[model samples]
Target: MAKARSAIVSSGPVGFLPVSITFFMAILMLLPIGSGASNIIMPHLVMISIFYWLSSRPLLMPYGACAVLGLCIDLWLNVPLGLNMLLLLLTRLFVLNQLKHYKGRNRAVHWGVFAVMSCGLYLISWILFSAIHSEFWPIKPVLMQWLVTAFSYAPVAFLLGRLRRWAW
Candidate 1:
């Protein structure tokens, strides 16, 4: 109970990312702007959110967290169950593979690379998912999602950078 109480109190500072993630998802779900006009193949918001935590604080945000978050995404967004699990797994692997590239860089370079890599991974993921499903969804929507997600990258990164020291 004491641990729970402290957890609740400590949450005051650490709550932003999780809250922002929900906000992004809420916007993604509620907004019908891109519905008839376009369809985004890659789930960029979820991908970007996962990438942020993976880069910023791997210890506090584990693969299990990623997996659960992915599952929540699947449940909340009503996508395939293991699809996001696979994406999260691949994202974790991608970040892990590039650990050296990140560890020795300034935060700007790091987040920049994070944005680029997330964009690339989303592309590859779109291909793989399309292939697995045996269809090409579309290019325009995915590209639009890339643009929006990349746009979101900077602010989320700025916030994460501010919270970096607190993460440890």
Candidate 2:
């Protein structure tokens, strides 16, 4: 019985669960479900996935995967090339670096960290976009996006946790 249990536990990565989940998230972000106004408040689903997976299972979610998915998001959103890629890569790094602080902590800590990181990422993006266009981009939409993404993090993280348990 011990041998059987160990075998089952050691069965390294049963499938492409991590990448597929993150890809599904990227697809969700790409879907044109709402009007332009609606998109302004769209949650950063891909970022959420990257952050969750990195924190939960860094081995399964690598920097290369984040970069690829970010590129897809950048292309889909038609933003400056590599914008999402940069953000996603940064997210992976940030989560990894800060993982020690939150690894054994409660979900609330994770949510708080996520909220702060999401806000920072959006602010950086807004700055970059403004610099690229050489004009002051309105801050309202950025704030809306940060709020939506921060509030949505808990539910999304919960769902991802469920997926991780089921898959792993």
- Cα lDDT listed for each candidate: 0.65, 0.86
Model 1 segments beyond 4 Å from truth? 1-43, 163-168
TM-score of 2: 0.89
lDDT of 1 by residue, 1-168 (tens): 987855664566564455455346545744545465565343355666667666654544467766776676667766667766777777888887787677767777766776677678668767876887799978776677777777776776676556555553
- Candidate 2 on 88-146: residue-level lDDT in tens? 98898899899998998999999999999989999999999999999999999899889
Best by lDDT: 2
Candidate 2: residue pairs that collide: none
Model 1 residue 154 lDDT score: 73
